[model samples]
Target chain A: MSLPTHTPVWRIKNSPEDSVVLDSSDEATFALTEEPVPSLEDGEMLVENVFISNDPAQRGWIQKGVLPERLYTAPVREGDIMATHSIARVLALKDSTDQRFKVNDFVYCMTAGWRRYAVIKTDPSACLPVMVPQNVSPTAALGLFGVPGFTAYYGLHDVLKFKEGQSLIVSAAAGAVGNVVVQYAKKVLKAKKVIAIVGSEEKCQWIKGLGADVALNYKSPTFAQDLVNATSDFVDAYFDSVSGVILDQVIPRIKQYGRIAACGAISGYNKDVGKPTMGATWIEVVTNRLTIQGFVILDFMFPKDGSNRVATEAFPSIAGALERGEITLDGTEDIVEVPFVDVPKVWGRLFTGANTGKLVTKLA
Target chain B: MSLPTHTPVWRIKNSPEDSVVLDSSDEATFALTEEPVPSLEDGEMLVENVFISNDPAQRGWIQKGVLPERLYTAPVREGDIMATHSIARVLALKDSTDQRFKVNDFVYCMTAGWRRYAVIKTDPSACLPVMVPQNVSPTAALGLFGVPGFTAYYGLHDVLKFKEGQSLIVSAAAGAVGNVVVQYAKKVLKAKKVIAIVGSEEKCQWIKGLGADVALNYKSPTFAQDLVNATSDFVDAYFDSVSGVILDQVIPRIKQYGRIAACGAISGYNKDVGKPTMGATWIEVVTNRLTIQGFVILDFMFPKDGSNRVATEAFPSIAGALERGEITLDGTEDIVEVPFVDVPKVWGRLFTGANTGKLVTKLA
Candidate 1:
């Protein structure tokens, strides 16, 4: 099928240093442009994005600096479209015999960059463009069953080997991934106590309702003491999102043989050489025999072994729980769903702690 | 049983700031003294040291500042007897009915300090003074089956969860623990390739005999490039003993899902605040989804759960392996067995790289 002549998109247009943390207002940093859409080929389908995800890792995918072949997902080069894991619709399927996809089917498009409409492959070997399972909103599909939620799932279940009745404390607890981790730890994993650290008091209250035993604002004067007080019995596991002072604060508070799933260092991503202010303390790690595991969601989703546990494990667990009404995305109540034009601006809000939970944008 | 009125001993005489990295020459840092021996109580035994183990962690046990009531062994404080894990002869047992220890038995005495003779407990609740398994020399028992060897056992088996046929790399390959790790990985774990990094060509040659596929002298000018070339398939596990610039060099060379057994930071032990030259790089840790675990030998020896895997698992395995003569301690060939008086001098050699393999002093 013939595609549209042109489609609007965003491409990085700055030096590698400034490529981190997108700011749409700065045209030099990120340029909004139009590119002619190429006609679809066999085994390919045209997908129109309905909702797109914004993650803190984009700050590390500095244009021109990110590796060309990162096993699963390659970072976009300068002048190329910025990538996002999005919920898109199969607007047009090029192959009549394609068993993987159908026209008008809602799909989880893995490589759906910033463009409004793009061609995505639906071959057997392709990792994304899977049908978004039945009866879930685009928000739930992208936010709950997407990268953010799956990251929480694997980081807890696999990395931490989280056990029931074990206490868990998470930093950036109001974020998309962090919120899901907090809820999953308390509701599904049956954590004895869940300590959620957020940036503001408002976010604090919001996360507390999502099964957090104690929601402490990291900005408070007594935050450190509050964390200490809350951890009467040192935590069994920690889910780290902001890795500067917050991670340093949590490290010493963990008990012996405790686990830390280092997911994101959002606070350090835009720094010089992408280094956090304080290096993760090694003393506590050694003295307490802590296990610090760092992970990216894509690894589990499209694993080299072809396990695809994200497809087989996380998606089913989250969807089943949602279906059984076991757990709700209560923390997503204040989600900042922006329009396609405001993707750049809302992304900036992530750094400023302006957004509450999963911050996505409506593309169509 | 009657014991000697006094026993010659060594004690920490310096301030806590100067406690790291032992320097016996500095009389102010470590001083020879004598402690009065008391009559043995019930379940107590008088033991005379045969061989005493010297470790880099003694530097961090600086006199006066170590925390008391640590879960396992407590660090020596200023003016107290400096402790050592020694093979001590059970000179006198207070209880003839004691099942854990008997007089004349060469026991693995956990709390035997740097002294000619001392008293240790043998109760069921007591953690140490374990009867050394028969059929091994003092060096073979302490260096090959003691803390150092068992450290390699659990670090690879538990922390790294290492598997056969996967590649492995280790630093300080000629040291007491590292030598065992190199041999065990190739001879026991059946690793496809084993890379052993050491300080000198002489030590490198020695480790090669211990089943290392490739032994690289880290001090060579082309060490970095040499390491890169050696990791053709990228290593699956890294057992770290020296955590300075060497650890930074090894992190990026690891494959995805690499496991790091953070055993020792000997290079940083005497540094300011016990910090290494370089904080472990976090970028590669996160990108590659690595798991870095730190552990202390005592934790496994006398675990909170009372599993005592060190006794139940490591000792038996090492003893059985020795019985079968499957592997040998070739790296401990250049042993420096100093007298009790020369300990102060040899202990300082650990930092200058003047000594090889295990550094122990004969004390009777």
Candidate 2:
């Protein structure tokens, strides 16, 4: 089958000094030019993106200085397109024997990320379930019902094994994964206290609205002390999204027999040679008998048991709670779904801690 | 029974700096001093020193700073004697019904460390034990068969969980714990390869005598490379007595899922507060999946399922092997078995690394 002529791709120019800039406004050197889509091969299907995911991890992938192999989702070389998540429709099928995909059907693909038009060489359902859930938005398939949600679930429920009546502290608690983590810890884990440590006061309140018992501003001068005092018992489980001074401080305060699931170190990605001064403070981990496990979500819910198994195992208990209004999403009260074209600008603003609610970029 | 008022006791002065002094001549500080002996109370037994154990850990206990609390086995209050291993004869008993003690029998008291006279309050039976073989001096019980020996055993056989045919690396391999650690790893644990990292070329030869596969002097400029080259499989277990530059290097080279029984950090003890920058390089712990557990011999072994259980469980097996002369401590063949009076001098020499072999101060 012939594919569309134009494919939208995002490119990173020079290494970003601190934050990733996606729009054409900044001095970022590279560009994701609209290129002519190649013809599909046998056993291949062409997918048109209906929703895309923007992750802080992308900051690591696009930056030239970051180790090339860290781009695990898809190998991104110089002049190649940046990678991210997107749910797309199978606009064309190259092989009749390809029983996995229909031409008009929708499928979810993670490796085939960011690009508007992709000539997927193999069946997408082989990686993640391709069957579209009725009533759930394609963007929801990329957000709450996707990798971010699974990461929050597995890290909290499995790795941490957080028990009831314990405090959970999350760093970068306003980001996509962080928001889901806060809600999961509070509602599903039945934590006595769920505290969100974010970069701004507004982000703190926004996370607090997402069923967090308290949201402490990590940017405040007294943030560390405030967190220490707020969670005086000290955290039973720490979900670290940002790894820097916050990690260094939080580690020393974790209670005996505490667990920490370190998913990302967003704080160090931009630093030239991010000498993260933070350490396990071995004395503390020993004295407290703490266990910290570093994990990538891809290691867990991928290849075989992807999101559906997690959603199936997870959603039953949470879905009823959600339907009963026991669990909630922050700023779900005032939803703001922006168009796909606004992604770069919205992503730029997201890092500034300006967005208050779930920021989903819609493509129809 | 009234305690003898003339029993000499040496008290560490109130001034932190005055408690420990490094001598320019001979380089040995007294392991124990002759001052007024400790007074006895109810339910306490006055134990006359039969043997005293000197460990590299004593250096840390007298260390001026770095959390002075870390320096003491028990708090060395203004007038209290420093505590350590003492195989003592019970001179006077406050209670005849105290089954933990018998008037003339010998018992090892941990709290009465490095002293000639100790009045231990607990049931003396509850303290650590050693049955002195008629041919082997009670002092040998302190060095070869007691705390140091137990430290080596627990560290290798328990903490690092040494498996037969695995590589083992022990720092300070000529010192008391290191000397015994290397022997046990090679002869008892049946380690395939045991690489001992020591201070001097002479000490390397000494460790070689202990049945080490190879002994490497860490002082060499090529120490890290030499260590890596020597241990082809990388270290399966790292028995760290010295946690300084060597450990900074070792932490990186540790094999995947390696175990570090961090018994002591003797390397950084001398430096004043924050003076010694211990480059931990803990990221290696995460990436390589290493487990570094710090332990005081007392803390590491005494509690339930701690080193005591390890000591009782492992000692007999190794002792049977040692009895057959399968394990021996004679690499350097330099032995400093001095009178109690020479302790201060020998201990001072210990810090300067002048005296070799286990310096066991003999007490009659």
Candidate 3:
């Protein structure tokens, strides 16, 4: 089989001070001589990637590691591949013994890259059988049909244990995952009220279009008071995707026996700053009978077995809901395709806030 | 029926400053004069005094309504009679409707006291039946066999679910409730280690005698470090009867899934002088997977069929162990017997820190 002489990559150079600043192109980036095409050994396959995902959590992954105890995601050495999730087609296979994939078959894989092609070994931890929906483009798997969707689904339906008639307060409610949570809490769980806390006034209205019962602009100085008045003395569950000063205000008002699912800390992701200063309040968890748990979807979501079998069974209903327009993606549902060479520029634009939804690079 | 010319009562003449000072002997205290003797109605009996209990928590009750939101206990109003647990004799019963009691019976009744006689109404919430053991003194019901013992028994055995070969750490281990917890955690629960945090070196050694594996004086500068060294990374449960600077140190070091049964917050009970501070730090809780619950005995120990069930079940084993000498109360059990006239002076001495385990007044 013939191989491409040059591959592409995007590197996050010096980090920025804020989200808006970091997402923009900086003078410090570098794109040097691309490495030669590598061979696939046993248990490895060479794949031409079709689509790559850019998520808000990717900002967190760049700044933090999988676990808090880890120093960073990259290897201790300086020149290491960063982590990413991509949908790829198998170009060549080394192991005839492996039955999960065949040459030219498309598979969703989580490996390092904005690269056009890479040699990936069969990861024992990751398995792929669910194909890209025939009705939707392959890039749709990167956003609503992929990690962000699963994270939103499991967080609301499982971790928060969303009950009917309960009120759910979700920060970042206009973003990719937040939009899904708002719809899931409303349509699937029949939540009595869904209070969307968004960064902007327009985004607040945008989330309301996605079936949110109420939307509030967190940018307002009266945000905390607005939340208190909106929930009407009852906030049963809090889905916290952006934890910062907003979380500090949200915690005290949660009703008795309330649950706060700490999904992600995106508010501080772009800032490679020191740990956030803590609020000096004792939460009196018992008096309120509160349960707060931190979880990552990958960490908690098991394979289609055990307790997660229920999640697998419910996956279709969630997907069906999305497909039938019961749950809607508000912005840029179409894949924004660019040549494989523009991956870094797209990534720079991603952090700059110029792009909306998933950014995928097409390979020829 | 003849009534006494004067009756004794402990009065907080005014809310005390930083320090707690009681005046049971001040003649200027609301005088009990020219009032007709209270008559016993049906379901009620007249209890002549035997012993009255002095507890540090009494100060907390006096500062705020015992139940912050609801008046569960009979109100302890200013200029009203002070309420306390007393082992008393049923001198007379005007009506014999309540099957639980009869005239001339030695009954343990919690009454408004520091007096010779009290007309106790048979309010189930206001009083509890004390079964005096032949081997144990009537005064034991005033403390070691009363609420303090029950608190320790339920909090450790039931709430903390104390396991053998696990360590149990308790604050204020020499205090009435804490001393019982030390005995129960060590002898009854058969915990591998019991660490007691006490105020002084004297109390530390005293707690150590009551089967505490290690006792650290909380007042010591290196107390937190000493506690850390003593446990050596194995702290399964923390029975926090005292919440103070001690809790601030113990919390960060607790093992994962550790249960903190926060029974009371005695350290900050009297805030008469200083401003109220932050309640509890939330980050330590999130990082540790800690379950901190503030509860009163009433929340769990609902008696089945009018028998104090926790007492009937847990008490037997505890009492049997006490009888067999498997558990011993530290010889510092200070039993102060005062005449009917001296009740006022003894009440004044309680907050001065002169008394220790089970301060009971005997009337013979």
Candidate 4:
């Protein structure tokens, strides 16, 4: 197979403002341009990017300066391909040295840039050969069988060690990670009560369809009272992705020995980096004996030995569930697929709550 | 052995204000009075209290009305004997039904009231027979080999699971639990560095003598900077007995996957029960991925099955250390032994930081 002669890529200019969409004057935040495809070296393969995963973490990565040592990520400089997880198809293999992947094979690359085509090392450590199971779409790989799915799996199973019949509250329940967390907590973990906090009535319905026992819109004026009423017996575990006010409200309601899986703080992502995000109080933590753990899925996926349990266990489990129709992406009507040029616009949908389920941009 | 005909007891009259001694106007916070000793009933024993343990948690228990459900202890109601740990000698046994304890035996009781003599249930579940090692003072049973020692043991070993070569920071390093935590972290766990935070220069010296690698007065103007300088690599585990600004400052300096053993929040104990204490931010907790656990030692000492690992393991370990001269309390000059009648006055010493070591009152 011949590789494309020219590939279009989105490059970061300036960071996005605290808004739903990049301002017109901040067009420099991201620019789309076409360039000649670079030649692949030995043990390299050329890939046609199919879908780019949009996540709240992207906001932290694109910021201009060095973040705190704790929140540190490789800075996404100007004119560089914005970093993301992407599903791609191997268009050409430069050498026959690597036998794990070949031409026409679909693969998932953690280092996939926001580009139409990428040159990825054929090293299995760099990318994995993705076998799209029957009846599961490639998009589902980015949602239910992807990073978000694995994050929820390891967080609830390993971090929180969520027990059967325990009550759980998930923040950002309609988003990529939260949706999967709600489903897994109820369907897989057998959680007694699954309360979901979302931003809109539509998201409440969306999360409810995903097997959430109770879904409350945080935007509702009765959000605080609704949370108290829903979790009268107190939650045994909390999966927090939006960690500002939601965390503050949930902290007091957590039962003694409750576990909190701190996945993301999207509510504070748009704020100035290093400025403290609100909601965590030591008083509640000490009084209630709560255990809070923050995690990044890559730590498990790319461990010191380079063996990824997510690929071996979480992905397979999610795939098997999908094949059996125990889990489905049927009601994900808001998974908007925008063209490659509109990557910036689609990425902004995450902050504005304009899109739901998994937001993926098609590059092919 | 004949029990005392009359016993002097301190009972709570009203709560205290901010002072080193209970205000005369609030003498109702506690009243010392002589009363006829109650005769022991079947399955009961009369004990002549030798030493009454004073702790900062007393402040929370003696608070006026119903505290928030989180900080609720059975309130030390007006005219009730203030509850505390005590070392007592069995003066008389009413019946021979329970064989675990007998007359003249020295035992430690969690239900020991603030009285010169107490009528205790001979039920093995309510009290444990204490074997005071030769050359080890009976008071040491309430300090180095008691609740504080066990708290430090389980917190670091089981809760935090602190390993050798890891760094640790301890708050309230001069208090009963903090003192034991510092010594155990250094002498037993072989931690790489042990940073102790206290309130005074005397406490700084006191904890240093207890094997802290570095000791800093949290009251010092440069305390925060001193903590950062002392723990350049960040702390792996924190044995926090004082949670307030110190907690706020130390949370950010915690390394990834750090553990915090929340033993007590003495700094917040004197404050209004329900009001939130400052210094713990969720950003660092989520960013650093820390685990914070609040613990009360009784939960471990008297677990649901009544089989205590503390009684079997920690007590023996501390006794062995004392017998081997590996641990000593000879230089604890700050252990002020106030008269039993002055219990109310001395109890306020914990909040004011005017006394140190194990503040005990002689009731014999």
**Which candidate has the highest lDDT of all?**
4
Residue-level lDDT of model 3, residues A1-364, one tens digit each, is: 6766556655545432344232334534323236667866888887777776666555544442223432123321213354467788888888658798888887777773666778877764433644445666666667677766777787787778888888889987766677778888898788888998887777677778887888998779888789778866668889886665677677666676678776665655544421342331222333454566655565444543446542564467677887777876547343557776656555554433344334555554
Query: Residue-wise lDDT of candidate 2 within A1-364, one digit each (tens)?
Result: 5558887766555556555555576565346567778887787777887666666666555555433322344435556665666667888877658676687776777656556788776644422444324455556555566667777877888778878788888887777778888887888778898988887877777788788888888779898689768866677889887665677678656675577786776665545324434132334443344555655566556535444555466546545555666655435322345654555665555455665444555554
Poorest 10 consecutive residues by lDDT, candidate 2 chain B = B271-280
How many times do residue backbones clash in model 2?
A: 26
Worst 10 residues of 3 chain B by lDDT: B273-282
lDDT of 4 by residue, B1-364 (tens): 3448898887776655422235555445677778888877898888877777887777666665534566635767677888887788888888667787877888888676887888888766456777567767778777777777788888888889999999999988888888888887888778899999888998898888888999999879899799889977788988888765677688877898788888776765555422342223445676667877777777777777868687688888777776666666776524556677677777677777776677887752
Cα deviation at B299, candidate 4, in Å, is: 4.0
Judge the docking of candidate 2 as incorrect, acceptable, medium or high: incorrect
TM-scores of the candidates are 0.82, 0.76, 0.70, 0.82
Residues A230-347 of candidate 4: C-alpha lDDT, one tens digit per residue? 9888889999987766777888888987888888887766653223422234456765678778777777766778686876988787777666666777765245566777777888
Q: What are the candidates' individual DockQ scores?
A: 0.28, 0.16, 0.12, 0.26
Worst 10 residues of 1 chain A by lDDT: A272-281
* Overall local distance difference test of candidate 4: 0.76
Task: For residues B1-364, write the lDDT of model 1, one tens digit per residue.
Answer: 6657888888777755533434555646678876788788887888888777777766656534544422235677777777666778888877556676777877776677777888777754332444445744755666777778889898889888888999999998888888888877888888999999998998888888888999999889999999989996789999997765687789877888789998876665555423322222455677777888989877776687878787788878876766666567544734566667666666767766666777776652
Cα error, candidate 4, residue B313 (Å): 2.3
Candidate 1 residue-wise lDDT at B2: 65
DockQ ranking, high to low: 1, 4, 2, 3
Question: What is candidate 4's CAPRI-style docking category based on DockQ?
Answer: acceptable
Task: Report the Cα lDDT for candidate 3.
Answer: 0.64
For every model shown, the clashing-pair count is 4, 26, 4, 7
